[model samples]
Target: MSQSPGILMMVIAFVLALGPLVFLHELGHYLAGRWFGVKAEVFSVGFGREIGGFTDKRGTRWKFGMLPLGGYVRFAGDMNPGSQPDPNWLALPAAERARTFQAKPLWQRAIIVAAGPIANFLVAIVILGAFAAAYGTITIPPVAGPIKAGTPAATAGLREGDRILSIGGREFDNFNDMAAFTSMRAGMRVEIDYVRDGQQARTETVIGQDVSKDRFGNEVRRGVLGIAAPAEIVRSTVPVWQAPIVGVERTFSLVGMMVDGLGQLIAGRVPVSELGGPMRIAKMSGESLSLGFESFVVFVALISINLGFINLLPVPMLDGGHLLFYAIEGVRRRPVEPQVMEWAFRGGLVAILALMVLVTFNDLGAFGVWRNLAGLIG
Candidate 1:
């Protein structure tokens, strides 16, 4: 079966956006494996049945697959495609066993596994840094603008021209910093330090929650302080030398946001409905592409950071799971038993599959698939 033009375009765009990131992530594992004297048997750009491939002189088979979702690298002595250690790795010829991933030193194996996530972060930093250097950034002072009547800002005595100095001990030079901080603390009371007419003062206010919808009609709830930015705006051209620094700062800031959101979710403060999956990501990818190259690049950079951070999670069947095993080995002075590793990976696979189902259901709802179906049936 063939897809319609619109569907095809979405598929292509999704691949273009994700393919490079996946390739780089897998390449990190391959290159690190080679560096540490482990032999890579296969390098794939997707999963399932192979579409096309060629063997290199070093005997690595590089191939593409039908599924465009993600890719993986298979090292020698991998028990299965998922890279579990083979029980027979010890029985192989000494020369061949020496080249197997399981035979490598603990540090080498850990590096090989960690290299994937590290590459993702590096790619995001480079893309964001390049854009920052080329296009610069916009800035507005943290001075208070007109407070919305009957809102939290007005209730807390925030007045026009009051310059925001800090929130929760974090100082800011731009309104964005304060806004970012405030928006994340919905329903939480915090001390806001500011200067009104050159007199230092502090006000405690609980951030108000407002529910709004995006262009796609997805509901979003955010903390609204009922404060607006000053009328004046500033645009500054960042030097190439400083762009990377700015990129690093921006990357860390985004990571912090993710951490905060995860913490909120775990604490039962945030609803699970806000979580999105592949369909939501595809819809977002198309929307971002329509917004132009800069917006799309920024979106990609953000996703890349997320990819890096998520892979570092200590879940089985992920890079972080492998690292966890290595950590245990380091502490216990021996490798985790192959049977235990197998069961862990199996459990991880089940957990991952369940998560996928949940997120996909959420995506369908977010995309209004059920609503549209109901409308048609009605």
Candidate 2:
């Protein structure tokens, strides 16, 4: 087993991986707000007290905060980092009020709020595309190479040389797609379609699962089909012109996986202990860094996608929450009542804080902090 990276390395890796992504996310919001004539009062990476900063020519105070978890852009007329509207800003003269975020048209406000997450998605796409362009894409046919006896695939009547057509109604483009899909569906029964000797057939089997730990000692649980990849592999160099298209397709594929994972979590098919916070991210970042530069860059891209997807969740205090509010206002042709919005935001904040605590606790447990403490006490 490989040893985990030291604590200092983990912290440095976390900062390196998260800092630029957070900055880009906020930059997306700031640029969009400025485009609509909104004056950005502050552009800070992270939260809480300002550690170091300077005012830009546009009067935007660019700063770093004490906490290095996430970032925000406070536009004019915003009461706080959450972008709540300030009633006091309403008293501003016409010229100044016009430059406030809240004073912008409803559509513009929605765009500004959405830009942050969109930026993260774009970053993932660009990175993935660049990788494809550089090293090309490798694909394997979704044909069973060897079926281990008594495994899910074997039990499902699958045989060697059988070509997989689909699983759980999703068509397979490559063996990797099939493997990735099955890996996340552990213990769930799903329909599998394949062709044997030019004849199509279908069967259902419960996906087998394996639980193990990575080199860093983090637990990993994955569904196993007990069918190996075919011997033949194909690699194709992606054209520079088509890289972006490949990027978009790959990005959406990842988003789909995220949706599937979230659904599993909600359905209780997966343990809530799988939820991770900053500590898990830091560990993964350090481990990826130790592997090599390419692995580290890919890890960053994956995190970028996660950041984008999570922000789009309809939970309050997220970019998605703001979009939800804007959607309601659009239909009603009026903003949600201030008191109602306030209460909703408060509730959202509480929910967010609770989730953070839960994930942090899970992280500590995964790291053996609780176990070590118990050993010492005993």
| TM-score for all models, in order of appearance | 0.91, 0.97
Tens digits of per-residue lDDT for model 1, 139-224: 89999888999888899999999998988677989998788777766887778999988899999888898998766455778888
TM-score of 2: 0.97
lDDT of each: 0.85, 0.91
Candidate 1 local lDDT, residue 99: 97
Compose the digit string of candidate 2's lDDT tens values, residues 1-378.
757988998998999999999999999999999889999999999889999999989999999999998989988899964577787888999999999998899999999999999999999999999999999999899999999998999889899999999998989979988998888788988999999999999999999998888777777898999999999899999999999999999999999989988988898877889999999899889999988899999999999999999999987789998999899999999988877777888899999899999999999997899999999999
Model 2 pairs whose backbones collide: none
The number of residue pairs in model 1 that clash at the backbone is 0
- Model 2 lDDT on a 0 to 1 scale: 0.91
Q: For this target, which candidate reaches the highest TM-score against the unseen true structure?
A: 2
- Count of clashing residue pairs in every prediction: 0, 0
